[model samples]
Target: MRLLIVEDEADLASALRTGLSHAGYAVDTAATGAEALAKFGVHAYDLVVLDLNLPDGDGLLLCRRIRSVSGVRILMLTARASLADRVRGLDHGADDYLVKPFALAELLARLRALLRRDGDTGEPVLRAGGLELDPASGEVSRGGVPITLTRKEFGVLRYLMSRPGRLIPAEELLEHVWDEFANPFTETVRVTVGTLRRKVSSPGGTPPIETVIGRGYRLVDR
Candidate 1:
């Protein structure tokens, strides 16, 4: 999944971007609320790590603006720890809140919790046909055999698995699986899907993924 970290602290933003990237998320950062909104307008993010104290605008207002536009998950990460602050943040549209000086592990757990609520099921392990994916463990397997995939491949499979048998356009995949740095017109999705197909296919077995000419790709529910 992709995330937007809106933090004015250079050190914190850098740390968050690095840490979240290592945790298998496409991450981007904005040091001000204006920059965050600009980036948000240009990219599709699964979640937002918003700080309440932005240089250009209040994070609560920004959160409201984002909430007004989309239902994307929001997690307010800030130094505000009072009960009123928490309630106000949630009232402003944050799905979750994490105080500063928090543990990355805890933040990840919270983020996963938010994503789980938005996903197809709350089982933690996603299953479709013979494929099994554990988002928490970052593991994918087929028919009891473990399958390793690149970050992009894993993200693509995760998305496809979420809505099995539904056609997904390349633009949708690029928007969600890749960060803002990806070129929208590039053939990256097709190439990544090609490589992913080879890795997940069983010996002498038909591939689980299906492609439609002039359309998009689908993960057969099978």
Candidate 2:
């Protein structure tokens, strides 16, 4: 999943980014409200890890702004532990709230819990033909045979399998599965998809993933 983390503490922001990336998420961060808005405008994020204090503005205001524009999940992090503060955070549209000095494991677990219970964004197991994927466990198998995959490969395949027969452009995949720093001009998406196809397909007649010349790709279950 793609995420945006709005935080002003350099160490904290960097640590969150590193941890989330290691957890197989495409994460981009902003240290101030202005920077966060700019990134928010350009990217589609599954969630936002927002700090209550910002250099430019109140995080609650930013939270309301983001909530007004999108239904993306927002997890507000703050030093304030008062019950009133938590109520305010939720009223301002945060889906979840976490206090500072929390453990990294707890943060990850809370984030997972938020998405797990979400009706719209829940991570459901995806299956197409003999291929089976467990998003929660990061497991992929074809015809009951396990398939090993890199993080990117898993993300790409998960996305493709989610939509089934819909055509997905390479740009869309790059935007959603890769971070903002990914070079759009490079052959990264194509190369990664090619490698993923080879891994998932048996040495046989045809790969289930189809390339329609200039159009993009569609995964066909056989």
Highest lDDT among the candidates is held by which one?
Answer: 1
Candidate 2, which segments miss by more than 4 Å at Cα? 116-123
Most accurate candidate by TM-score: 1
Between which residue pairs do clashes occur in model 1?
Answer: none
Give lDDT tens digits, candidate 2, residues 136-191: 67889988899999999988887788677889999888887899899999999999
* List of clashing residue pairs for candidate 2: none
Candidate 1, residues 1-222: lDDT per residue as tens digits? 889999999998999988887777888899998999899998888899999998888999999999999999999999999999999999999999999889999999999999988873346898985799998888999989999898889889988888888999988888888887888888999999999988988899889898887789899867
Candidate 1: how many backbone clashes? 0
Q: Tell me the lDDT of model 1 at 64.
A: 99
Candidates in order, TM-scores: namely 0.95, 0.91
| Clash counts for the predictions, in order | 0, 0
Model 2, position 150: C-alpha lDDT score: 92
lDDT of 2 at 55: 87
- lDDT per model vs. reference: 0.89, 0.86
Q: Report lDDT (Cα) of residue 202, candidate 1.
A: 86
Give the Å error, residue 22, model 1. Answer: 2.3
